[model samples]
Target: MRVVVGTCGFQRGRRIHYRLLDAVEVQQTFYDPPPKSQLESWRREAPENFEFTVKAWMLVTHGYNLRLWRRLKREVVGDRSAYGGFKLTRENLWAWSVTLESASALKARIIVVQTPATFRASEDNSERVVEFFNNVERGGFTIAWEPRGTWWNNRDLLEETARKAGLIIAGDVLRERLPPRGQEIVYARLHGLGGAEVNYRYKYTDSDLEMLASIICGGGWREAYVMFNNIHSFDDALRFKQRLGGWCGS
Candidate 1:
């Protein structure tokens, strides 16, 4: 398994803790805006064998101009007042691509677009999802789609489309929304084994780690990127990495 660890922020500098990781997930600017220089410096300090995966900006998932209350209204009451002024089109995707490409010099492995839970799966929504992937494909980057809903109800169709387009399925142990197995390349964001989840931390048991390790070992993904969202400090992630390394005999 080719594991990638995630960090809340990478702006401080890469020399901080990236040496302990095979890849680092940049999550700080996913909501606010892009900071090219900070990301670039991370790439410079990262090990030669290291890879980086960045979370797509929130504008891509949450609608750039739509306000929080407006989005809630739309989801709860199906209101269009919030969307009336915003131009949600393919063009905006290019802006995200540009931001992603800013770190191209670092040879990023995958650009993760984690759709909010509000975006449900339906025939119409799936078409829009396909269109989004098509637009992003135009730019030279590999995309990993992580939809929160049970979007893979049509796994055959969704997986076929994803395979044809060369997009990777972002798998998660906690969600199980997507197929549990099978994909050319797999990208997973492991939040934890699941239990009493706090705001940012999760307590993963030994059995949970073993189970995930089994799936990873069984699938034989060309490369697997695992980002630990349970990070309160680096200790948990470091311990998990060590545990996973032992499992893999790395």
Candidate 2:
């Protein structure tokens, strides 16, 4: 199996991070996608073998009420209702286009679309999810969905939708098990563990890394991408790579 380990974002200087890991899931793409020119510059700077995974812009996943919307570079005008929750509207599609362009510029193969927990598993939301996935132009990029909250209550529907849409479910392996079929790669994110659904203050222990290694190795996927999202992501990811015997020399 080919296991790729890295942090959600650069934990150190670019050159230093490149030497420590082989992959990275760019978090900036989520809040505000950078210009293609900037992304291209980053791609050119990284080693040819380095892999980048872009996160879909917030306009594509979060609602107007989401606090992160304040961080958007471009202000949303009137009628913000049609903006998020996978509305399949022109605005959301445009956001996806920008996200795709950013990924293309970075030569990234994976784009993670992470929905907020507030996006429930209701009928309207479900339809929006189906429509959004069915109509979007993938541009030969692997789109991974990270559905949170009540979406997991209906496991069958979740797997069915992903299967029909050819989506890989990017999940926190500690909290949920990814679908066993319909995906060639295993995309796992480590978001820390504590009182809340996603806690960033925690640090992973050696035992946690051991269990994580077992989960990915036993998943039966030919390739796996493991991204650490906690505050200690840099150190934890390095530990994970060592555990998997893929250490890149610290």
Candidate 3:
């Protein structure tokens, strides 16, 4: 099994982290898709064995949250309010296209589509989910879905959707203990503990790291990715690597 342990985003500089970590789930692409040259430059700079997973832009999932729309004003390529939830709107389709191009440039093996807690598992949303995945050309990469909110409460729907679409049900392993929905790829994000669905400020304990390592190593996945999204991601990721008998970077 090939196991990759890293952070949601580099805690230190990319140059430093690139040497110390072999994987990273790019977060910036979700807010704005960077230029192809920049993405390819990143992929080129990294070691050949490195794993780069990109997150789908918010325009693919979240609705018209004016707050973020205003925040991403300069970054917004076009109308920011055009996509959200499970609506396969024109804007959302454009966002997916751009996201795929970025992933191709980065030579990413996985792409994450994370939905906010507000995105419930209603019939409309579920059907939209089916349409979106069925229609989108995922290309050579694996599509991982991190559905937040009540979707977590409905494992059957999540599993059915993933099985049908060939998606991995990526989730916070700390909160919900779910086996890899797909044998192809196992993906997990550590978003800290004890604060809503995500506690970004929390640091993991040694015991927590031990338990995490055990779960990840025990999971029968062909490939596994563990990413730390908490503030203590740097330290925790390093420690987890050590526990997993993993080395730093290539």
Strongest candidate by TM-score: 2
Q: Give the backbone clash total of model 3.
A: 0
lDDT by residue (tens digit), candidate 2, 160-184: 6676667888788887657557477
Each model's TM-score?
Answer: 0.76, 0.93, 0.92
How well does candidate 1 score on lDDT at residue 147? 67
Compared to the true structure, candidate 1 yields what TM-score? Answer: 0.76
Give per-residue CA lDDT, model 1, range 31-99, as digits (tens): 543456766776777777777777776655655444643332211222333221112454455446554
Please list the C-alpha lDDT of all candidates, in the order they appear. 0.58, 0.83, 0.80
Better of 1 and 3 by TM-score: 3
- Which lDDT value does model 2 have at 211? 78
Question: What does candidate 3's lDDT look like per residue over 1-250, in tens digits?
Answer: 7778889987888876677777999988887677889999999988888889999988888867767666463244556566776566777777788889999999998999998878887667777788888888787788889998888777777777777777778888888646444466678899998979899999999878777767676777777788999988988887887667642222
Better of 1 and 3 by lDDT: 3
Using lDDT, rank the candidates from best to worst.
Answer: 2, 3, 1
Error of 1 at 179 (Å): 4.7
